[model samples]
Target: MKNELWQLSACELAEGIREKQFSAEEVIYSVISRIDEHNPRLNAIVADYREEALIAAREADRAISSGEKTGELHGVPVTIKTNVDVEGKPTPNGLPAFEDLIAPADAPVVRNLKKSGAIIIGRTNTPELSMRFTTDNPLHGRTENPWNEEASPGGSSGGASSAAAAGFGPIHHGNDIAGSLRCPSFCCGLATVKPTFGRVPAWLPSATAERGMLAQMISVQGAICREVRDVRLATRIMAHADPRDPFWMPVPFEGWPEMPEPVRIGVTTESYDHPIHPDIVESIERAADYLSDAGYAVERVATPSVNEAAESWLRYVGNEIKTYLMPVAMEHGSETIQQIFEWFFQIGGVSDAEDYREGIKERTSMTREWNLFLEKYPLILSPYLMQPVGAWDSDTKNIEELRKFLNSGIYSLCVS
Candidate 1:
């Protein structure tokens, strides 16, 4: 029964708890045990309150026994990235300087997760500021991949991905700017989607959102999971209209596609000139081939680049992010963002009228380019990374490369 419990989906686990097939305590303990066995090796969890988790599990059980409608995640253990706020937990966002900075309140995403009946089991590690794709922070050290501890688990979301892949949780909340979520999912062999931008609200008290060229780009907060159904479930749980977020667009919660068991899929191991690992290319093709055999259109082709999406991400996020680095910069800290800031600082943090016009011109061209592509393919299959995961040490090896994005920070943490 214990082994069987490990195989259950998020929904299945909830049902078991609800039906008294097993108590919430049973479920939580099983998960906690898994975390104990695996997380130490993976080093994914930086801070944990297992005793608190058990108490929360009891409350969830009581709520169920009292006949109140239990939340979707009642008794389900979920790991929050250290970057996100969780009451007493300091949302360091991978920064050592802010390790003592506790959030007075839960971030909206956390509030929503709790409202939906999920248990906050632990906090995961992340690269400083979650700036890189590989997860390693000065405060919490690196999170190793489950498949190969020597390799990366991918950054920012790396700890989350590691936990999820190793069965730490059925679903994990994740954020993305430069592929923090998607890259790790690719490497870890899971499914994650970064919805059209602004779909997920972003509000961290200490953190600022990027501005300017990134205004139209999406900086969504969503979930990662082993099953597709869990993805949709967690998304619904978190996608409420937050008027506080100027960018939140209301998407239909009820009539999402209930397509056949197999949906039409467009698969590609290539996108632009960025080469993906041969094994990954083969894996994607094999998955596509299997899907094709399962009756889905598994065609290989070039995917549309969201024009200005990356640039827009930089700009919009930059607008807010530039400020995050300012205090640190003034103190001559953060060797990572310093060089990039150097270029911006030279311009005196002010774009000339001509520069503003040129930035706008580039955005228009990029948006136009993206729309042309998404128009054809509603769902795309593309490579998640260029190479296999390497030691977490690689990220800090050449601190200069962090600025260049040559070594994807926690964003590329994966099984490869």
Candidate 2:
């Protein structure tokens, strides 16, 4: 019996399948079975194509046996956020009116993943238009956190984070505009990386709005992984320039050295006036101190001002998501969607166009400041949140609390 059913990383499984210690089909089957065993309870995976996945796995095994060379991720199982397309699957983004819509073609990221030999097993749920953090929408209901079931796994990439954290896959593809990748990893104690903007391709059909300035800054497609090595792996595999996204640079992925040298490390204990909870504060201190102990020069600094950029970023992002919901609001005449749009427009309108421009200036200044700081400091160790992971309380029972919970993570992480 080839007992390959458990928490092995992608590399491990790929090696196992290559050596014939186990079949890629076996791994896909095991993952599907495990997800089926848990998904109904958590409501994480909204639409699963287990049969297709298993068949693909079998084909992968046959190809390997035929001595055909496969990409780096050959025969590995993985899942994607529902916001992106998968050819035949629906890219719902959690809108009920749009459930029938299907992608005629795969998003560039999906194409690369398949080309790299990753097996597509499932498409996970996301908040409506992946707007807010917690994974809840009309289409998929809600996706519970795997750790402390009551707590949020963090979103809009919440499902991807939960699946990866729960051992559903070695790597779950996700995107980040505001801490979507990093916040969940913080909540789950998983390692995540937010690559510089345009390092990864993003060509989703559901996106009907222009990229705005976020095209240049503050948006990235990164990974949440258990090992730093996987961060490097995903970057190497997916960071290649996709001309589809003209923003992507025609540059090769820069590989990290065998050992990153101990350099100047900047530490920010309080990025905002937001008090860091003791447990989280201690965690930050420990991380900062570790770098110091490792012989890196540590410098304490005040949190950089992110308020202006945050306001602009929120308005632009909120408007984009609301625009995505506009068609739904029209078809179903949804009170929720309409009201959300009204509120979004109200706030966005209040910002004079020049105010938006000023915010961009603020963002540019901050980025330059960070760049200058990094010029001397090779690394910056900072907190992903103001608090520790707490179980979600069902009693909260209101969208207001959910709103607060969703914004708190970004408020905590933004200043630096």
Candidate 3:
């Protein structure tokens, strides 16, 4: 059981612990040992908490023995991405200058995870300021994909994805402003949901200022997991109320009424001429087929042009990045990251102040179109990445590669 404990999902681990099939200490030991064995080469988890985790596991076991109530994630080990605040730990966000900038307190996501009885096993890596699509930085080096050493694990939350795939733990915390959560999940063949904005409370205790409007509206905290059940469980825990985040919504995690009989699902393989791979198209079709076979009324339908939304995102968010975040990148980020930022600006083409205001006004129309479409078809099955995952450093090679990388994820950016 010790040897195979790391392979279990969060739900399974919690149930086993509750049933006294395995002590929390045994589970922690197994996961920590697995991390110790493989983490050196992967560099997925930069801030290991093995000693502290073992102690917490022992306490969890004691509580269980005493017949105390346990949270849904009790005894399950999880990793926090380095970008989020973890009390007393450095939230470098892969920047060397901020490598020693310790967090004043846990972010809402961390607090909620702790309250849910999840053990913090380690802190995963991210790209500098968590801006890029690939995970590599001077502070944490790089997090390689377990499936292929040369391929990217997926950016921003790449470390979280790598850790999950390599069997470090059952759940890993991550955030998605654009593709941070879904990209890594796609690359690692895991499960995740970039929850609707305001679903999961989020805040950085060490932050000195507020984020841009687009950042505040779009960014969301979430979890990456090997199983969809674990994703569902972890997301509910993370969605717990927090006063620190003003945007956090009061929403129930489950118990929603079922959809009408024969739920209709919108299916689209429209690439907007972005050069989607045939394999990717086939995958979407196969998934639509599966859903249809499962009693869904799947139909090919056109909603809104994702390309237009994506372009708007680039113009609006790109300008915000230049105005608010570019200074930090220019001053402290590495040459590689700086170059990537340039490519982002060049491709997105920053909008002027008036144009930005108009774009914001126009964004609502786009959202309305999607909402109306969704009201008719409850679910939409579409391609995440238009093509397969690329090499780890493909984005940094040159402008052409960077544009292609961003282009591949148009669907993800459009939603964000």
Candidate 4:
């Protein structure tokens, strides 16, 4: 029973602890044993907090014994992505040069998780500067996919996904700027939701400066888990209000009134010049069928232009990266990372200063179009990546391959 504890979902663990079926210490030790067995090979967790975690678990057990009120995630173990703050821990973000940059306080997501009684067992790995889609960095090395070592676990939340799939923990905190959360989940066969923008509060106390405007809008914090229920639970916990992030919304998670009978679901398979993998098309069709069977009004239809939005993302974000982040990358980033940044510029096409302002303005129009479409069809079912998952290093191999990889993610980056 102790050994099997590591295999349970966060939901299961929380219930078990709440019911006194098992002490939090027992569950933590089970997960620690699992990590000891697998982490050396996978390198998913860069910083293990075994001693600290055990202490926390014991405290949680004591609180339960005292019959105190418990939080939603009481005693469930989770891993925080190294990019975010964990108070007193270094948020290296997979960069070696900033190894000493310790955080003074927990980021809002971490605070929420802790407040909900979740214990952090470790900090997960990420690519240098959390820029790449594949997880490898000078700070913590590469995190291997548990299913296929040669395959990518996905980045910049690759470490979180790998750890979650390997049973290091049930909930792994991750943030998505350009599909960082979903891409890793997709690669690792896990479940995650890139919560609507402003749904989850975000802030890094150790950051030297704020991110660019576009990045602030697109990037969001979330969790990856083995079960959709765990994902939903973690997402709700992470959405708790934080005074630090002014963008955080106070909206309820599930209080919306029921839609008219046969809720509309707009389905699209538009690949737009990129080869749409047959498996992806079949997946979409199957999902639409399932929704229809479940009483949804699923319709095959053309929606707004994902390609145009994707292009806008590239141009606007590429220019911001060039202006704001390139200098830092040049100063502290590895050569491989620098080369990848060059390819990003090549594929994304940096906009001039004049065009950059105009593009920012154009974003409003693009968002308006998507919002209007969503008003008619409350839900959209579309292919996230047109092609099947590629090799871990496919994006860094050459310019052409990189472009193909970026093009494949048109739906993902554009939807954000």
> For model 4, where is the 10-residue window of minimal lDDT?
254-263
Give one digit per residue, the lDDT tens place, for model 1 in 214-292: 4335456778788888887878777766666677777777774555545556665543344445786787778777778
How do the predictions measure up, each by TM-score?
0.83, 0.88, 0.99, 0.98
Report lDDT (Cα) of residue 341, candidate 2.
52
Residue 90's lDDT within candidate 3 is 92
Q: What is the C-alpha lDDT of each candidate?
A: 0.68, 0.69, 0.92, 0.92
Ranking by TM-score: 3, 4, 2, 1
Which runs in model 1 stand beyond 4 Å of their true positions? 3-7, 206-216, 256-275, 297-357, 399-416
Give the clash count for each candidate. Answer: 34, 2, 0, 0
On residues 1-416, what C-alpha lDDT tens digit does candidate 3 reach at each position?
67889999999999999999999999999998899899999999999899999999999999999999989888889999999999999999999999999999999999999999999999999999998887999988999999999999998999999999999999999999989999999998999999999899999999999999889999999999999999999999999999999999998878955788799999988888889999999999999989989999999998688999998998899988999888998899999988888888999999999999999898999999988887888799999999899999999899999888778888998889
lDDT of 3 at 255: 91
* TM-score, cand. 2: 0.88
Models sorted by lDDT, best on top: 3, 4, 2, 1
Candidate 4 global TM-score:
0.98
lDDT digits (tens) for residues 129-226 of candidate 4? 88899999988898999999999999989999999999998999999988999899989999999998899999999988999888899899999999
